[model samples]
Target: MMKATPESMTDADGLEMDRCFSTRGGVAYVGLRDRWPWYTKRRSASWPFAELRVADDKIVISSMFGKYAVTRDDVASISRFGRIPALYDGFKFVIRGDYEAVVFWALWGPPVRAAFVRHGWEIVG
Candidate 1:
């Protein structure tokens, strides 16, 4: 497995993987971790966590494993207060929208499915 290093700074998905002390326009991508379960297993998933450019007022959330990019405008709804319960030891953030949420629902497992169902946050596909 490849570790984060100056030489391997950029991940296979073309995202910066270093967890630097600070960045200029860094903001959370939201739902990235949940989208890709194999992230930790693969070194490619290390990048998106670095610094993300919220291009066009939209957040392009790539799957945790860095396989695909989840579209932003497809969001149908957000948490009432923009908060979701902890998924990965309080490190993960859940942001439910239309397109991405639907994809999430289809991809999530039994517990996640049950939780999302209880939240009444599903959007029709």
Candidate 2:
């Protein structure tokens, strides 16, 4: 369980490094997230869809519904998981909120995971 140190800082890349990711320019990573009614509210499962990025000390998740932001200070930990649905490999970002955000692994997963680890966030496999 690693933690962010006082000296740790994001480089010129903002949050996730766009150049290092498989995602298009200006985005850190691309992954699936809760859509529309969201997974928790549905009787049948809907496919996850979203984009992940870091900006101004907040982790931002952008979806068709809009964007959700979690401050870096609010994050408790990030853990890797593979549950339900085929290829559901994802990570859960636990924060000081009533809900936690789930990011499904994509072509962007590996590099972003490495980036988060490098960022000194508490990342558990």
Candidate 3:
């Protein structure tokens, strides 16, 4: 699940502004782009947070573990999955390389598509 800091950052429509609007990468970033969402394994383990940033010629994924760069040559394959039957659908991707990294997000399709397109990554799935 997505958690927010200070717990009162929703928009007027009661939507989560922090989660829905924050952009870690791309050219035209808008909304509450201040906070990065934190991902935890359980309730006790250390949180692993990731941010996508567009470098001069590559897209970078920086996280608690390490950093990975996705170039134009890298292939991005996407898959949809969820723990619940239909309530928590999310997307996951694997970038193939020696330093391959998998990223998951609860974001909808369009934004995810736009991110890949903007970075010139080839979407294979």
> What clash pairs does model 1 have?
75-98, 76-98
Query: If ranked by lDDT, best first, what sequence of candidates would result?
Result: 2, 3, 1
How does each model score on lDDT? 0.31, 0.49, 0.41
What lDDT would candidate 1 get against the real structure? 0.31
Preferred candidate (TM-score higher): 1 or 3: 3
lDDT digits (tens) for residues 1-125 of candidate 3: 98767458754434344333233421111122224732223211111255544322454545555555555566455444332332322334445543333444322445655655665544444
Estimate, for each residue in 1-125, the C-alpha lDDT of model 1 and write its tens digit: 96666656754444444421212211233333445561232132232243322222232334443322323444434332222345221112234441222122111133433433443435222
Between 1 and 2, whose lDDT is larger? Answer: 2
Q: Would you estimate the TM-scores of all the predictions?
A: 0.23, 0.52, 0.41
lDDT of 2 by residue, 7-101 (tens): 45444334544322223111122232357543241111123456666443556655555555667777766677553344444666655654535
Per-residue error for 63 in candidate 2, Å, reads 0.8
Q: Which candidate should be chosen as best, given TM-score against the real structure?
A: 2
Best by lDDT: 2
Off by over 4 Å in 1: 1-50, 62-64, 67-73, 80-125
Better of 1 and 2 by TM-score: 2
